[model samples]
Each structure stands twice: as structure tokens, then as C-alpha cells.
Target: MTIQVGDRIPSATLNVLKDGVQAITTDEIFNGRKVVLFSVPGAFTPTCSAKHLPGYVEKFGAFKDKGVEVACMAVNDAFVMKAWAKDQNVPEDLMMLADGNANLARALGLEMDATAFGMGLRSKRFALYADDGVVKALQVEAPGEFKVSSADAMLESLA
Candidate 1:
């Protein structure tokens, strides 16, 4: 079953780029915080690059003002994620997390197979409001749709 609101996020390691090195784990991120975590199918893809991530990047401050830490995760490696963040002109507040091995995605039951597109296993597009490791709100897109989970939409939920 897919994860739902009130589910506790599974303990899994995530690849994070910091100071030319790799830092891993979910605890480092959600131990005791209110987080707005969003996942994309793949980095540099059409909707993900043009709309998904940019939406979060744009509203990052609003999230912070609402006491939410913003994070963007993809199945790509840290190098790719960091480069994509730079390409997207990501600011410092929005964290780019890498689920390179898809372990986290699989744990959350949100893994997607895009092998037909030359991309391997990846994450589906979704967003969640997590407080100290437990989910408070969850929104998963109905495959190829982007209606309710945009950054603005998530912010509206907090209001």
C-alpha cells in the first residue's frame, strides 16, 4: 500500500551533497522538524525541471515563514541533483536530496519504473507534510497529472 497521511516515514538513507562530499540518511533531515518533502520522477525531465522543482524553489521562503523546511528529492545521484539545482538556480534554503539507489522511494512505495524512457527506477511525483518523522498530509499525483501537489497548493494547505 502507498503511504498515507499519519504514516511514519521509514528510516532510510538519502544522498545529500555537502561541501564536495556525500552525507546520507533520513534522520539528519526529519529528526525533529516540519518538512515539506516533494519527489519528482527524475531530474532534468520536462515537468519536473520546468514546473515541479521550480515551483518549490520559488515558494521556498513562504514555506520557511510557515515553519516548513523544503526538500526536493529525486532518484538521481548527488552529483546530478546538485548540478540540476544549480541549473534551476536553486537558492540555499531548498535542499536537494538524492535517492540514488531508490531505497527511500521503494520504502515509501512511490517507486516508478521509467526504464522505457532510458531512465531506470525513480520516484513518482508527490508531496508530503511531515512533522518530526510522521506524515501529516500526503498528495500523490494521478500519474502524469500535476493538479494538487504544487508548492503553492501545499502552502495553501498549511493556511
Candidate 2:
């Protein structure tokens, strides 16, 4: 089952492109912090590029004002994620988490099969408000749908 509110996020390793490839765990990112973690099916897909990811980037300051750490994750490798972030001009305040190999996605039960699309394993579009390792709110989009997981939607929910 997908993670629910009050559920503790699974400890999974995620690769990040710092100065170089660095491995970080879910606990290091989320434990003892209020985090707004959003996931996309793919990094540069149209919707994700145009709206999903941009929404969060645009609202980075707002989330920080609320004392929330903002992170975006995809099943792509670290290089792609770093490239995408640079291309999109992702601010330093926002984190680009690479869930290479779908470890984090599968651990969270949010992996989607997109082999037909030639993308193999990917993460479903979803967003969660996690506080100190415990989820406070979670939104998972239906396959091919985008309604409740946008940054504005998540912001309103935080209020």
C-alpha cells in the first residue's frame, strides 16, 4: 500500500549530485524536519517540466517561510536529475533527490510500470507533507491525472 498519514517513511538510499555523487538516506533528509517531498514520473516530461516541478520551485520561499524543506524526487539517475535541475534553474533552497533504481519508490509503494513508454521503472506523481519522519499529509495522483499534488494545492492544505 502507498504510505499514509502517520506512517513513517521507509529508510531508503537516494543519490544526490552534490559536488559529486553522494548517497543520503531518507532519515538524513526527513528525520526531525518538516519536509514537502514531491515526486514526478520523470524529470523532464512535459507536465513535470512545465507545471509540477515549477510550482514547487516558484513556491520555494513560501515553504521555507513555513519552516519546511522542499525536495523533488524522480526515479532517474543522479546525473539526469542534476542536469534537469540546472536546466530548470532550480534554486539552492530546493533539493533534487535521485531515486536511482527505484529503491525509494518501491519502498514507498509508489513505483509505476512504464516500460511500454520506454521508461521502465518510474515514480508515480505524488506529494507528501512529512514531519520528522512521520507523514502529516499525502497525495497520490491517479495514473495520468494531476489535480491534488500541485504546490499550490499542497500549500493550501498546509494552512
Candidate 3:
């Protein structure tokens, strides 16, 4: 079933390029921390690169100010995520999570089929707020739409 408010984030490993491709666990990320984890369909895709990721990059500080750690997730490999991070000039603390196998997406029941677009299994464009591993809010966008999951919307939700 789709993860809902009050659900604990499931345990799963995700890749991040720091020093090398490091496997980090969901527990390590969400435990003891208030986090806003946002997912994009794929890294470097038009909407993801142009708007989705950029919004988070731009408002990262605001989240930090609110004591919320922000993470950007995509169903792409670690190398691609690292390259995209470099291209976007993402901040040091803004985590780039690589869900290469769509594990987290499946675990959350948020997987979307993008094979028609030439992209295989992917996660839907969504954002969830969690406090110490338990979800407090979630915003999922409709296909071909971007609204509720934007960084601005998340920031406003915190207000």
C-alpha cells in the first residue's frame, strides 16, 4: 500500500556519491531527523532538471532554517546523480539519493511505469515530510503536473 501519514519509512539502502558510491540506509537518513524527501522520475530529465531539483536546491536553506533536512531522490544510478548534482551546483548538505533499483519506490508503493517515455521503472513526482522516520505529510503530483510537491509548496506547508 502507498505510504501514508504516520507510516514509518521502510528500511532500504540508497546510493549517494560521496568519496565513492556509498550505500546509506533509510534508517540512517530518517532516524532522529525531521526530513523532507522529494522524488523525481529521473535525473537530468527536462522537468526534473529544469524545475523539480532546482526548486529544492534554491530553497534548501529555508528547510534547514526550519530544522528539516532535505533530500532529492531519483530512480537513476549514483554516477548520474553525482554528475547531475555537479551540473546543478547542489549544496553540500543537500543529499542526492540514488534509488537505482526503484527499491524505495516499490517499498513506498509509489512506483510509476515510465517505459512509454523510454524510461523504465521510476518513482512518481512526490514529496513527503517525516519526523524521525514517521511520515507527517505527503504531496504527490498528478501525471504531467507539478504543484503540490514543489519546494515552495513544502516550505509553505511548514509555515
Candidate 4:
């Protein structure tokens, strides 16, 4: 079953590129903060590149305007995520997390078999609001869909 609202976030190590690759734990990322964590199936895919990520980038300031921290994750390596962040010209405050081994996906029971696409284990597109590591809201998109997981939708949930 998928992780539900009110569940304490499962512990996992995700990576980010700073100077070199650095491992960041769920505790470090989510503890004592209201976080908006959004996941994509892969990095650099058209929709993910042109839309999913940019939506978050465009709204990063607005998210902070409401006192929320924002981060985006994918099954790519820290290197790829870093490159994508630069390519997307994302701001320094909008973190890019790398679930290099799908650890977070497995922990959340959000793993998907994308073997047919040669992507292997990938995270279904989703977004959630968490307060000091406890989930407040989660919006997971249906397979092949992208409705409720947008930043606008996430911001709406806060209202």
C-alpha cells in the first residue's frame, strides 16, 4: 500500500550535488520544516523537463511566501539532477534530490516497474506536504496522468 497522510515519513538517503555528491537523509531534509517534496519518474524526459519541474521552479518563491520549503526528486543520479537543475536554471533554494537507488520510492511504496521503458524502478509522479516529517497531504498522479501533482495543486491544498 502507498504511504498515507499522517504517516511519519520513512527514512531513506537521497543525494544532492554540492561541490561533489552529498547524501541527505529524510531526517535532515524533512525534520522541523514544512516541505513540499515532488517526485518525477525520470529526469530529462520531455514532460518532466518542460512542465513538471518548471512548475515547481516557477512557484518556488510562492511556496516560500507561505513558509514552505520545496524540493524535487527523481530516480536519476546526483550528477544528472545537478545538471538538470543548471539546465533548467533553477534557483539555489529549490533543492534537487536524487533517489539514485530508488530507496525513497521503495520506502514510500511508490516504486513502479518502468522496465519496459528501460528506466527500471521509477517513482510515480506525486507531491506531498509534510510538517516536521509527518505527512499532511499527498497527491499522486494516476499512471499516464498529471493533474493533482502540480505545484498549483499543491499550493491550493495549503489554502
Candidate 5:
């Protein structure tokens, strides 16, 4: 089953590009923090590049003001995620995380098989409000839909 509100984040390594090197961990990122974590199907995909990520990028400052640290995750490698973040003009404030191995996605039970699309394992689109690593709110989109769980909707929930 998919993860839900009040669920504790599974401890798994995630690739985070830092200072020209890759840092791997699950502890420092979410532990003891108020985090807004969102996942997309793939890196540089149409809707994700165009809308999903941009929405978070645009509202990152507001989210910070509300004491939420923002993170975007995809099943791509650290290099691709870092490059895509630059292409998307993702500011320094928002973290672009690489779930290259899909460990985190699988742990959360949000892994989706896209081998038919020539993409291997990937994450379903979703967002969560997590406080100290425990989810407070969770939103998972219906397949191929983007109506809810948007940054705006999550922000409104925080209000």
C-alpha cells in the first residue's frame, strides 16, 4: 500500500549532489525537520519539468517562510537531477534529490513500473508534509493526473 499521513519515512540512502560530489543518506535530510517532499515519475519529463517542479520552485520561499524545507525527488541519477535542477532554474533553497536506485520509492511503496515506456522503475507523483520524519499530510495523485497534491494545494493546507 501507498504511504499515508503519520507514516514514518523509511530510512534509505538518497543521492544529493553537493560540492561536485554525491552525498548519500536518509538521516540528515528528513530527520528532525519539517519537510515538504514531493516525487515525480522522471526527470525532465514533460509535465514534471513544466509544471510540477516549477510550482515548487516558484513557491519555495513561501514554504520556507512557513517553516517547511522543500525537496523534489525523481528516480534519476544525481548527475541528471543536478543538471535538470539547473535547467529548471531550481533555486538553492529547494533540494533536488536523486533516488537513482528507487530504494526510497520502493520503501514508500510508491514505485511504478514504466518499462513499457522504456523507463525502468520510477516513483509515482505525490507530496507529503513531514514533521521530524513523520508525515502530517500526504497526497498521492491518481495515475496520470495532477489535480491535487500540487504545491499550491499543499501550501494552502499549511495555511
Candidate 6:
């Protein structure tokens, strides 16, 4: 089922590129922290590169100031996510999570089939706010739309 407000984030392992590709579990990320996790269909895709990720990169500190650690997730591999982070000049603390197998998306019931577009299974564009593992808010965008899940919109929801 789709994760909802007050739901505990499901357990999953995702990759991040640090000294090398490192496996991070969901418990390590959401436990004892306020996190804002935003997902993209793929890294380096037009809208994701130009807008969605950039919005988070720009406002990362604002979210930090409010005590929320921000993370960006994509269904692409860790290498691609790392390259995109470097290309975007993403802040070190703004985690780049690679859900290469789309496991987490599938677990959350947010996986999208993009095989018709030549892209395989991917994540739907969405964002969620969680405090110490419990979801506080979630904003999932309508396909082909970008209104609700933007960093600005998520921040506003926190306010």
C-alpha cells in the first residue's frame, strides 16, 4: 500500500556514493532524524536535472535550518546519482540516494512503469516528510505535473 501520514517508513536498503558506493538502510536514515526525501524518475532527466533537484539543492540549508535533513532519491544507479550530484554542485549533507532496483519505490507503492518510454521501472515524482521514522506529510505529483512535490511546496507544508 501507498505510505501515508503517520505510517512508519518501510525498511529498505539504498545506495549512496561516498568514498565508494555505500549501502544505507532505511532505519539508519529515518531513525532519530527529521528527513525530507524526494524521489525522481531518473537522474539527469530534463525536469529532474533542471528543476526538481535544483530546487532542493537551492533550499537545502533552509530545510537544515529547520532541522530537516534532505535527501534526493532516483531509480538510477549510484554512479549516475553521484555524477548528477557533482554536476548539480549538491551540498555534501544533501544525500543522494540511489534506488537502483526501484525496490524502495515498489515497497512504497510509488513505482512507475516507464518501459513504453524506453525507461524501465522508475519512481514517481514525490516528496515526503518524516520525523524519527513516522511520515508527517507526503506530496505526490500528478503525472506530467510538478506542483505539489517541489521543495518550496514541501517547505510550505512544514510551516
TM-score of model 6 relative to the true fold? 0.99
The C-alpha stretches of model 5 lying farther than 4 A from their native spots are: none
10 residues in a row with least lDDT, candidate 6? 140-149
Give the C-alpha miss distance for residue 158 in model 2, angstroms. Answer: 0.6
Q: Which model is ahead, 4 or 5, in terms of TM-score? A: 4
Please write out the lDDT profile of model 5 over residues 33-57, one tens digit for every residue.
9999999999899989889999999
TM-score of 5: 0.96
Compose the digit string of candidate 6's lDDT tens values, residues 5-124.
Answer: 999999999999888999999999999999999999989999999999999999998999999999999999999999999999999999999999999999999999999999999999
The segments of candidate 4 whose C-alpha lies over 4 angstroms from its true place after superposition are: none
How far off is model 5, as Cα RMSD?
Answer: 1.0
RMSD of each: 1.0, 0.7, 0.6, 0.6, 1.0, 0.6
Please give the clash total of every predicted structure, in order: 0, 0, 0, 0, 0, 0
Candidate with more favorable, higher lDDT: 5 or 6:
6
- Would you list the clashing residue pairs of candidate 5? none
Whole-model Cα lDDT of every candidate shown, in order:
0.90, 0.93, 0.95, 0.95, 0.90, 0.95
List model 1 lDDT by residue over 91-122, tens digit each.
97788999998998999999999899888898
lDDT score of residue 109 within candidate 1: 95
Q: Model 2 lDDT vs. the true structure?
A: 0.93
Candidate 3 lDDT tens digits, 80-138: 99999999999989999999999999999999999998999999999999999999999
Once superposed on the true structure, which residue ranges of model 1 sit more than 4 Å away at CA? none
In candidate 4, the residue pairs with backbone N, CA or C atoms under 3 Å apart (3 or more residues apart, or in different chains) clash, namely none
